[model samples]
Target: METGERRTATERTWMFPPVTGWTFDQVKDLEVPFDWELVDGVVVVRGETALWHNHVRGALVSVLRAAETGPYAAVSGQCVMVDEHNVVKPDLIVCDPRGLDVFEVECAPVEKVALAVEVVSPTSRQADRVRKPALFSANKVPYYWRVELDRDQKLAVHEYWLNADTLTYFPAPSHPVHQHKLITELPFPVEIDLDSLVGF
Candidate 1:
């Protein structure tokens, strides 16, 4: 390694003030400069998402926002407190916002969230597929969706519903893989044209 070599932002490690006894309430109150989430009561900072990921999220959010009827609305990047120790921020959340201002909500209760969505990125494949779904299922989030982009950039959507008896996610009646259209009615009636989501 050369002393003069420059490191990219992603290559550099950023540190926050060292502290212990980090609770969700305490961590939420602290003034932090970057995006972070609570995993087992520890603060894990996240890297910025890629543009293609953003394209899928924004496009899908727009579709959900329009498809959702009455009290429901698609809210992006909201924190759902999984428990006392785990707090996860899903790419999108759908909930009834009849009483409160959804925009002003920083930490949303799992009971209030009807559905959670995640757009898979290269760096987050493991978390998106395994950890996030487990957390959401354990917390009893009613519905969950995982969006993926294949090698040719064709979109794929995976849908799941919570099994109350088991407290885990069960696959939807059908799974429409690569470049297929997804039409579902559990959480809400939404016909998702997977190809339409990945324009970039």
Candidate 2:
């Protein structure tokens, strides 16, 4: 019979042995330092975010939360289960309040999400620009927003609405409140001040 200490050592050694082909549930069970997303049974690990990244996320969340009305609330860094095989954590999400229970810890179902937003980062550019948008659209998420900060720190927001018939996103024109503000009406009426957000 194996001793307790011996068994503990063996378990620890094999605990995180290669996560390839893992399901969202499996990845969720692990003790990982960084957020993990399972895309097509492959694990995508997120790196540590920078100060600017966090600042932008905070400003965006504040804007959304302030404008939120009736049943929808802005949440940050929450895992969204796109399907059994795919799970992703968007930078910011606006979701139905009923779908989330503060007492329980779990990923929000994709159906409960009203809007998904990804703020571009150096490490996440490709996935944010391509994979995530496609996944959100396929799951019939009503709205998607992308925030891009250029080299000169100029901010731009791209909004898209899901076309139910085609199950794809069609770009929606952003309503500029002025030289520094961008406004949108979907999900809710919200205006973001790019100059203040980026310290321009």
Clash numbers, per candidate: 0, 0
| Angstrom error at residue 124, model 1 | 1.2
Model 1, CA-based lDDT: 0.76
CA displacement after TM-score superposition, residue 51 of candidate 1 (Å): 0.7
| Candidate 2, superposed: residue stretches over 4 Å from native | 1-20, 174-179
* 105 Cα displacement, candidate 2 (Å): 4.4
Instruction: Give the per-residue lDDT of model 2 (tens digit) for 110-151.
Output: 999999999898899898889898999999999998888876
Rate residue 11 of model 1 by lDDT: 21
lDDT (Cα, tens digit) per residue for candidate 1, span 1-200: 22212211122322322233245764666455778877876677766888889988998899988898877878898888777567788899998766666567667878788999999888778988999888888888888889888888788888888999898998876653424688888688888887877765
Overall lDDT per candidate, in order of appearance: 0.76, 0.78
Model 1 misplacement above 4 A? 1-21, 98-104, 176-178
Clashing pairs in 2: none
